[model samples]
Target chain A: MTALEKKFVSFSVAVAVLFGVPQTVSAMHIMEGYLPPAYCVAWGAVCLPFLAVGIITMRRLVRQQRKTMLLLAMAGAFVFVISSLKIPSVTGSCSHMTGTGLGAILFGVPVTTILGVIVLLFQALLLAHGGLTTLGANTCSMAIAGPLLTWGLYQIGKKLRVPRLPLIFLASMLGDLFTYCVTSLQLALAYPSAQGGVGASMTEFLLVFAPTQLPLAVIEGLLTMLVIMGLETYAKTELHELREGRRGLFHDAE
Target chain B: MTRNKKIVVVSLLIVVLLIAGPLLALKGASFGGSDDAGSVKVEEITGGEAEPWATPVLEQLIGGELPGEVESLFFCLQTALGVGVLAFGFGYLVARKKYGGDRSGTAGDKEKNS
Candidate 1:
C-alpha cells in the first residue's frame, strides 16, 4: 500500500525471479523408500528437537520485529526455490546445491533447518521429490548438519574479520559440499561395502556424487553472495537490524 | 556499476552456469534423481538381491508410484502453497507493523517513503 511496501514487494520479486525460472532442477533427493523404516524413524526423531528450537526462535523473532515474519516467510520461499532448482549434471548422482548454507548464513542453522525440513517434507509427500522414509536422513544432511557447519564457519569468519562477501561465499559453498558428504556417508552406512565395509562404501558413494555436487557448490556460493548483495542493497535497514546482536537466533531478537 | 546492477549481472551469470554448465561438462548424464541411481548401485553392490527396507505410506496409499505428470503436479501445488504462505505472511507483518504492532513501531516506513 505504502511506497516502502511497494518497494519491498518489487525487490522481493527480483530475488524470487532469480530462482523462479524453471531450469532442469533435478529433484536430487534420496528417492522415496531408499532408507529403512528404522532409519527413517531415527532421522525423524533427530529433526524433532531442532524443529522445536527453530519454532521458538522464530516466535522470538516475530515478537522482536513484526517484520521478521515477512522476512522469514520470504526467506523460506527463497530457500525452497533455490534448493529445488536442479541442474542436470552427473549421470546418476542427483546434483543440486542443498540450498541450506546460505539460509543458515541469513537466519542461522536452526531457522534454516526448519525451512529445509518443511520443503523436504512437501517435496517428498506431494511431489515425490524425495522419499518419506528418508526425510530424516535428507533433512539431517541438507538442513541440520549442513547449515550448522556453514553457520559455524561463518561465525568463525566474522570473528577473524574476513571480508564479508568472500566469507559468505566460502562458508555457503562448504555448507553445500558438506550436505553431499553427509548424504554419501548416510548411504554408505545404510549399505556397507562387502569389500571395504563402511569406508569403501563411503568412498564409492562420495565418488559417485562428487563430480556433479562440487561444481554446484561453487555456483551455490556465488549465487548466495549475489542474493545477499541484492538484499543488502535493497533491504539494508532490515539486514542491519537483523545482524545487530549476531550471536544466534537468541541474540538477534534480544 | 551500481550494487543492484552488479547483483543482477552476477545472478544471471550464475543462472547461465547452473543450466548450461551441466550440458557442457557432463556427458552421459541421465540427470536422474539420485535415489534411483543409488538404489541401483546398492542392488549391484549387494549382489542384486537387495530390497528396500520400507515403502512410503503415500506410495502404498496411491497403490504404487505416481505417474510422472502427477508427481510434477504435486510439486507445482506445493510450490504454489509455499509462495502463497510466504507472501501472506510478509503482507501481514508489514500490515501489523504499520498498525503499531511492534513495541516502538509505527508508520515510520511510510514517512521514509513519503
Candidate 2:
C-alpha cells in the first residue's frame, strides 16, 4: 500500500474501532453474562498472561526506581480516589474512564496493569464497581485493553514519526475508545436483546455507549495529551535523568 | 539528611501514603464506624455523601475531579485489580522460590519466544 493509503487505512480503522462499536462495549463494565459463557471463559483465559507479564515487569522495574514507582503508585491511588466521586449520566446508568493514560505513559503497560488491577479490585471489594464473578472480564476490558492498545498505539505513533504530543493523544484516544469497544462487544455477545434478530443487543449496546464514549474518549485524549505535554516540556530533563540515571524499581528502558 | 536517606525516606512515605492513606480514609469515612446518620440521610437525598475533611485524602488518592457511579465502579475495580496484581506477584515469587525452577526470564519472554 502507498503511504497515503496506509495512513488512511490506519485512520479509518481507528475511527471504526472507536465509533462503529456500541458504547457499552466501548465504555462500561460490560457485565459478565453479556458474552457467551465460552467467550467470557476464553477472554478470561487470554487475560492471564497479560496479568502475569504485568506483575513480573512491575517486580523488575520497581527495583530500579523505588521512589518513582512509589510516586506513581501514589498517583494510581489518587486516580482511584478521584474515580470514586461519580457523576450521573443515565437515570440508572453511569460510566467512567480509568484515566490510566498517566499511569500507562509513565510506568508502561505492566505497571499500569498492576495499577488497574488494584483499582478494580478495591472497587469490587469496597464499592461494588462490577460484580465479583465478572472481575476477570472487567479486568481484561479496562486493565488489559486500554493500556495494551495504548501501548500498541504508542508504538505505531512512534514508528510513523509522529510528534510526542499527537502520538500520546492518539494513543490515549485509541486506548480509551478501544476499551469501550471491547466492553460493548462483550455486552453484545453476552446479553443479546430479545429482538429475535441478528446482533440486536449488540446494536443497542453500541448505540447507548457511543455518544457518551466518543466525547469521553476525546476528553480523555486531550487530558492525557496536555498532561504528557506538560511533563515532557517542564520535566524532560528530570524525567530523563530519573529514567536513565537512577537505578530504581520502575525502570522500563532497562 | 543525605540524598540517599532522603530518597529512602520519601520512598517510604510514598509507599505508606499509598497504602495507609487509603486505609485511613476508608476507615475515617466508614459510615459503618460512625454515628453519622445525619450524613447518611444527606447521602440518601443527594445520591452520595462527601466529607469536606476527607477531600484532601481523596484528592491525594484518586485525582481532583470525582467520577460517577459507573466510573466509580471502574475505579474501585481498578484498585482491586491492582491488589490482585501485587498478590499475584507475591504468589509467583513464593512459588518460584519454593519450586526452584528456571522461570527466571518472564512471562513476556515466554510469549515472545513462543
Best by DockQ: 1
Number of the predicted model whose TM-score against the real structure is largest: 1
Candidate 1, residue A119: how far the Cα is off, in Å:
0.5
DockQ of 1: 0.29
Residue clash pairs of candidate 1: A25-A86, A26-A86, A32-A131
TM-score of chain A of 1: 0.83
Give i-RMS (Å) per prediction: 3.6, 16.3
TM-score of chain A of 2: 0.73
Q: lDDT tens string, model 1, B1-114?
A: 986687668767876876686677777766776556667777867888777666666777898888888876775665576567656754655555556554334356666658
Q: What is the lDDT of residue A205 in candidate 2?
A: 52
Residue A73's lDDT within candidate 1 is: 70
Model 2 Cα lDDT, one tens digit per residue, A1-254: 33553464455445444533433332246432233444444555545555555565555456554435533654475346434433222212334556677666666675676777776666554543453445656777777778778877776777889977668777877787787666666655554444533266555556556544554465566656654544443333335645663222223343
